[model samples]
Target chain A: MKRKQVLVRIFSLLVMLSMLAACTPAAAPTAAPAAEQPAAAEPFEIAVVVKITGIPWFNVVETGVDRAAKELGVNAYQTGPAQADPAQQVKIVEDLIAKGVDAIAVVPNDAKALEPAFQKAKEKGIIVITHESPDQVGTDYDFELIDNVKFGQHAWDQLVKHMGDTGEYAIFVGGLTVPLHNFWADTGIEYAKTKYPNLKLVTERIPCGEDQELARQKTLELIKAYPDLKGIVGFGSLGPIGAAQALKEKGLTDKIAVVGTVIPSQAAPYLKEGSMKEGLLWNPADAGYGMVWLAKYLLEGNKITDGMEIPGMGKATLDGTLVKLDLIMDINAENAESLGF
Target chain B: MKTLLRRHEAYVLLIIIVVSIIITAVNPSFFSLENLFDLLKSMSLMGVFAIGMLFVLISGGIDLSFTAIATVSGYAVALALLRYGDSLNIFVIFLLAGAIGILLGAFNAAIIYFFRIPSIITTIATSNVFYGILTVLSEGKWLYGFPTWFGDFANIRLFTLYSPAGNPYGLSIVTVIWLALVLLAWFILRYTVLGRSIYAMGGSPSSAERAGFNLLRLNLFVYAFIGLMAGFGSVIQALLVQTVAPNSLVGKEMDVIAAVVLGGASLAGGTGSIMGTVLGVALITLLGNGLTLMHVPSQWYDVVIGLVILVSVGVSAYRMRKNIQRRVITETA
Candidate 1:
């Protein structure tokens, strides 16, 4: 009986140890910096909030945030709600404000919903930085990975190459209300209308890029509804992969070409299989790294100038509280494996 | 056939049929054979997992941890497959997932049974713990690229059908598994002694104990089964999407809960049917899939889902009243 009790106790001890080990990664980066900060002034507590956590896009962003934190010797960390919900984000920001972080960087799930939270953060004298959310209120500055309009036009250019600049094509965004995605859709459609007059948008913009299953279902429905759909430009990271999978399932890989922003590894198989023609993206890690660096730069009371070469990001152009950088990545079958997630 | 009309699930089915007709009128291709088969594949995940939730709801409790269980089990299996998957059969993978699910479900059950706290609050707390631990361990990374054979299960089909345009489609293996689970749950609830005891316990825990029912065993059974369902669901989701994303499944709990309640399951317990749960899931899936096919604006999606959940809760409340009134009539007679 004593031995059985001992065994059970040992089992629980092991479980507790593993949980501690699991938490160490998230806590270690912040904890170690604090312990060593006696000789130096207090490090900045910068938190870069993304739209959602645990997806490939933001996971990559977290890595970049870590890299910048280590390089700059700042108490920088990244967090967001598990899923993209504005209310959860507001709650997270409220907690951060309550804790009195030095700066709060956000990639909004819903920009307008976050206005009140950002305003609260600003009132608390917290430095506010944002990425992928342009024209958002209550931010000191918004940094963009690429020109949204140009990014859209680039996707259309790739689609035009594969699809011969003509036929009934469709557009898809991360969500109908996702600001950057809609901007891309609008600019891409406009560019296509002027350049490729024969090309047609067969349907209204679909909001399927955020969830793979929804994207797959919508793509299947699209096929059944419009069998002649020759090209598709998807705006979200998961969109093209979903479209590619659907086309592959129906043995229409050669018939329909898909292009969008996708994690390379996820798109590699689809790219090799010929279902997805191209995936255009900027390294999200770079965006995360750049957001942190920019926040530090502003907090140090530095005035920004146009055409400044920012580390982790390239040469930048200023657009009145928005930092625009050019670092677009064109991922194809051959190089998809090399462009790490 | 005549008595079937009295079933609450029958009305949900009728609603689905009516909705289908309306959608088909606007988009002629909405009624196509290919779309139906695609939907059969699409709705399989929610339909299968909601059955697990159905038992809990019927037992006068709720379990919100199923999605977290699914995510963890799915991630675990994905990691396992990455290490040594070529030798493992698909069924063995399912077993691994279910075992993991059962352990977690037992965790939720143990808390609720020992503390006697409301199952909703307990499950909700446990779900956060489960998902938080998962995020830390996974470091929020999505694992892909199992052995080539791993992809084969998703392609397995009972039969292939060609649409009018000569495009081939099939009812997926995921749908087949869901149907099999449906039958198993129906048989248990319809014919087994354990099933009746569950109903009794849900009606009144004290009354059930006095009548010699084992509350511990029943609690263990229902919670473990929900976890088991989550385990199978994780594998099914990976098969369909061909990727395992940790955060994708957890926030989708409301749709399943809404569907089961809509299908005629009373939250107050003492009643629920596998048939009703299935019809409820169908109604939810039809709205999502049909709206997409008909090209309704995407922002309207959430509003419709919210309305379904609201209407279902209303139905459950009204049914409780009707149930009480019938009991009074019986007592007087």
Candidate 2:
């Protein structure tokens, strides 16, 4: 009976410990006043949530958050799910709500999956600003670093310039259901058909699942299947890096032109060696900085309007609570070093 | 011959060869020496983890924390590299990682052994704790800009072969380490007393204790050894990717678990071999590579893998039952 009691005590203790561990927020709450108070007196406590943590792309985003926090005099910190899972992201937001954060900024893994959490944050009167996910419901504003259509067209233009407006090209997205990636692919393909009539898509946009290894494997298979494939466009951050590696290994660096969205630091070697001709991405740090800037803007009782210049991101146009900024940087050999992830 | 054919390892090897032939038929490039080396190199990281997991499985325990342990240990090495930069030796980095792994592994072993908690439940809970602590500490950051020597480690080739299409393929240093580890594990399992004790414990703990084996010490050693391997695997993974992304390796536990199971390791414990685990890793690597080459949609990949595992396990279980029935009948006669 004594042993049983001891075991039960230990079991409950274990359960308590685990609960405490799970509920521990990624970023400790800073002592700042609530969002309801007009803030000239205390720093605004804003939480920036990302899709996943510990990758170069999001690392850069955190740097921006730090810079914005220092410059804007806001208590801003970035946190996200350890992996790209929306449910985990929701739990983080719920914890933030309980902690009474002034505002929340996010780069959601799934826009719809995060809807309920965003709704709850808004209901709690926390200002919510999201980046990279425009279709997200229940956010104060959704921002895009580049217009999705124009971004696709930019990729198409690069492909045409390299392939000389002819021959076979392939498209790789993170996944079919990843709205942003598929948007780029669909727009690029449609633009290519009307503009570069001779250019052919080798396959329906193949999903690489945002994995570098999968992207490399798919690129290798595409090369074998289409032998004369002239170019490749990767829509996800890892897609271009993987495609470039595969082409380089196959000794087809000169034969195929690889263009995609990738971190400049990760793509520097390939960009220098000419395996990857170009990379397209808005500075993630800029987006991170902008998200916090906007959150603070709304908190201070400022209304967003078209043609209003915002710090870090210049001249944003408001379209039904979505802020669109055309700030995509084209990364090439000469500019790759300067771009910095 | 019949006995050899009936062996689980034989079945796994057959699946590997059959898959290879089919892939080669569809895409002749898959048959090249370069592709073969690429497949092996790709399997090397998972192969290391599988070997570690094989020990856990054979000892009548499950460890869901291997990937978490790997990430934590690997992150330590990455931070150490960044801190010391050119002043740090690669050997010291690996040593530090291994030490961290052992400590974490010992923690898991102690709790499970003392509290008598089912290993799977304890590990699942511990994995979350370890990962949670890591995330909080690192805040989901990545470590990049390693020394050039470390960056080049993954690509260090001993011998090179050119495919007909002129792609250069080579046996990487990482692959050499993986192969060496496999040999070492096979040696330990086949010849060491601790290895014998592990088998005994898996078969029946009471019997193992009656035979005068120290259960407490053996449990500690087995879990610690797995931790050491997780650390080693993490370093290999970091080198392969050339960047340490904290969250990148967490969900890969499924792949490692699947490889061990497919290699003929029974989850119920007491049955597994290093050769079987290696074959299993090779088969999985080949399946992914072959399917990609065949242009099978990425979405279908998971479904296909699930079916393959189910079918293989089903067949193996059937054979095991039939052999048991035969033994019972023969004994009565």
Candidate 3:
């Protein structure tokens, strides 16, 4: 009975300690505005949450958030789950709500999974701005850097040009479930079918699981399987990089063309060598910067009307709380280094 | 010849051949020399880990921490390379990685030996700890920007074969290292006193102790040895890719475990061979490679691998039952 009492005490102590720890970070942000701004009004505290932290894509996005924070004088910071798990992301959002941030901007891994937490944040009067997740509900606005159909058509045009308008081409996406990636793949294939009659897809879109090695191995096998394959359209950032590496190693760069939504830094060497012919992506930093800008715009009683200029993101079109922008950056050897991401 | 046919390694070898033949029949490009070399090169990394896993399995312990050891050791090497720059000797980086691996391996061994906790559970916990430390230290960032020599290391081809189109292909130095490790492991397991003790321990711990084998020393050595192999595997992987992602290798412990188990190594303990492990690695690698060559959807690959494991285990169980029945009949006679 004495041992049992001790165990109960210890368990309760642990519970208390964890609650304190959770409250500590939440408390620190609140204290910051009070301590720093004694004379002026409290700065808008905007928290930008991404799908995952510590990846190169989101790392670039964080830089944008930092840039916007500096420029706008808002207490803006970015946080996300370590892994791309929707449940973890929702937890972060809930914690942010508890901390009483004025606004929450998120890029969700799963749109439906995050709706409940987002709904809670909305109930607490927290302004919610999301990027890259158009289907996300319970948000004041969800912003997209590129129009899905337009981007798909653009990628198809580039692939057609490279393939001389005819050959067996393969398509790869980050995963079967990533909605945006699949949208791009679907529209790209549809556009190709209508616009370029000669080009053919070798197989249904293969999923890379966002892994570079998996992409590389799949590309290697694809090359072996289809000797006359002329082009590859990669829908994820790492897909083209992996395909290019495989093609470069086999000395098939001259024979085949590869294009994808790849980071400029990773695709630079491949682009220069003609292994990777083109890369299509919007500036992630811009998207990151834009989320905060949109959040602050809504917080200050601004309406997201069509053609209204967002500071970081240029002209935006409003479609039922979804702000879409056409900001695709065409990456090639000539301008790869200048982009820096 | 009949006995050879009945051996597990022989069955695995036959599977490899059959898979290759079918894949080649569908796509002749799969039978090319360059493709074979590519498949072997990819298999070398997992092949190295399987050797270490073989030791642990034979000693009646399962290690889930080998990949974690590889990640931390590789991260340490990457840090060393960054700190020392061009002036640092490459060999020293490898030695540092090996040392870190030994320390981590010792930690796992000490816990399992001292507390008598199940090795699987201990390794699972230790893997998380090792990976957590690595993530905290590196911030889950990828390490790149190695010296020219590091990049050059990956391109060091020995006995090159050139295609008619002038594309060079051959075995790499890393693959050579992998081959050497396999030979060394085979020698130790087949011909050494320590190896016999490990098998004895796995077969029955109390009897091994009665036979005067030091269980604690053997356990420590086996785990540490696996760690050492992990360290070497990490260095090879770093050299192979020329960029190290800390998180990329953590989830691959499953592949190593799968390969070891598929090699006819009984998870319950004691029976495995270096040759069987090599064949197992080759079969798994070829399955992935061949499926891709056949334009098989990537989603189906996981299902296929799961089915293959189930079937292979079933075959082994059936063979064991038959062997036992034969022994019983002879004893009755």
Candidate 1's C-alpha runs over 4 A off are A1-36, A120-125, B1-5, B308-333
Runs in model 2 deviating more than 4 A are A1-45, A66-76, A94-103, A118-127, A204-210, A213-226, A248-251, B1-6, B83-96, B325-333
Using DockQ as the yardstick, the better of models 2 and 3 is 2
**What RMSD value applies to candidate 2?**
5.2
Model 1 lDDT, residue A75, Cα: 78
Worst 10 residues of 3 chain A by lDDT: A24-33
Per-residue lDDT of B1-333 in model 2, one digit per residue for the tens? Answer: 135323899999888888889988887877877777877877888999998899998897878788889989989999988888788777887898899999999999999899999787777778778877787688667776688788666677898877666667789788998999999999998899888789889767778899898888988988888999999998988777667767667778778878988888766666788888998898888887787677676667778888888888779767876776777799989
Model 2, span A186-289: residue lDDT tens:
88888988999999987678787367766776777777666779999888787887788778766789989999888887788889998899888888888889
Instruction: Write one digit per residue (lDDT tens) for candidate 1, span A14-116.
Output: 4544553343223312112133345568888898877877778887898888899899978788887665667667777787898888899999878898898
DockQ of prediction 1 = 0.23
- Provide the lDDT at A265 for model 1: 86
User: Worst 10-residue stretch by lDDT in candidate 3 chain B?
Assistant: B1-10
lDDT of 3 by residue, B1-333 (tens): 125323888888888888889998888889999898888888889999999999998787888789889999998888777777687776787788788888889899999999998787688778867776666667667776677677677767898897665667798787888999999998888799988789889877889999899999999899998999999998888887666777668668767877887888766566788888998899889998888887787778888887887787679757866776777799999
For model 3, which pairs clash?
none
The C-alpha lDDT values of all candidates are: 0.82, 0.81, 0.81
List model 3 lDDT by residue over A94-150, tens digit each.
988999999999887778888898889878999998877777778889889988789
lDDT of 1 at A297: 84
Q: Write down the lDDT that model 1 would get.
A: 0.82
Against the true structure, whose lDDT is highest? Answer: 1
